[model samples]
Target: MRVLSRVGCHLCEEALPVVDRVCAERGESYDVADIDADPVLVARYSDLVPVVFVDGVEFATWRVDPAALDAALRRPR
Candidate 1:
C-alpha cells in the first residue's frame, strides 16, 4: 500500500496511522509519497492528499476507512 500525502495535512496525518495499524497487523509494508515532492503528483493529488493505494491502484481518499482498508488488504494480490 502507498499513502499519497503532503506535509502538515491533518487528514493525511489521521489516515496514515489507520493504514499503518492495518498494515502492521497484516504484516504488510507500506510507503508514503509526498505529493509535493513531484510535480505530476502534486497536480494530480494536490487536493486529494491522504489518498491510499493498494498494489498501485487507488483505494481510498481523504479519510481512511478501517473496514474498507482491511477488506482491501485481505483481497488476493
Candidate 2:
C-alpha cells in the first residue's frame, strides 16, 4: 500500500497514523509520497492528499477507516 500526501495537510497527517497502525497490525508494508515531489502526481492528486492505494489501486481518500482497511487487507489479492 501507499499513501499520497503533502506537507502541511492535516488530513494527510491524520490519515497517515491510521494507515501506519492498521498496516503495522497486519504486518503489511506501506509507503508515503508527497504529491508535490512529482508534477504528474501533484496534478493528479493535488486535492486528494492522504489518498491510499492498495496494490496500486485506490482504496481510500481523505480519511482512512481502520476496520475497512483491515478487511481489505485481509482479502485475498
Candidate 3:
C-alpha cells in the first residue's frame, strides 16, 4: 500500500491510522510518500494529495475509512 499526502493536511492525518491498521491486519508493506517532496507528484496530486493506493491501484482519496479500505482489499484486482 502507498499513501500520497502533503504536509499540514487534516485529511491526510486522518487517513494514516486507517492505513496503519489495514497494513497491520494484512501484514502488508505500506509506505507514505509526501507528495510535496516531488514536484511532479505535487502537480498531479496537489488536489488529490490524500490518495491511497493498494498494489498500485487507487483505493481511496480525500478521506479514508476502515470499511472502505477493507472492501477494496477484499476486491479482486
| lDDT values, one for every candidate | 0.92, 0.94, 0.86
Local accuracy of candidate 3 as per-residue lDDT tens digits, 1-77: 79998889999988898889977886667889999899999888899869999879888888888988877777776
Worst 10 residues of 1 by lDDT: 64-73
Model 2, 19-51: lDDT tens digits are 999999999999999999999999898998889
Error (Å) of candidate 3 at residue 14 is 0.4
- Across 1-77, the per-residue lDDT of candidate 1 in tens digits comes to 89999999999989999999999988989999999989999989999888999999999999998888999899998
Error of 2 at 41 (Å): 0.6
Could you tell me the lDDT of residue 66 within candidate 2?
97
lDDT of the structure predicted as candidate 3: 0.86
In terms of lDDT, the best-performing candidate is 2
Off by over 4 Å in 1: none
TM-score, candidate 3, is 0.87
Candidate 2 differs from the real structure by a C-alpha RMSD in angstroms, to one decimal, of 0.6
Predicted structure with the largest TM-score when compared to the true one? 2
Clash totals in order: 0, 0, 0
Q: Rank the candidates by lDDT, best first.
A: 2, 1, 3
Compute each candidate's TM-score over C-alphas: 0.96, 0.97, 0.87
Candidate 1 lDDT at 50 equals: 88
- Candidate 2, pairs of clashing residues: none
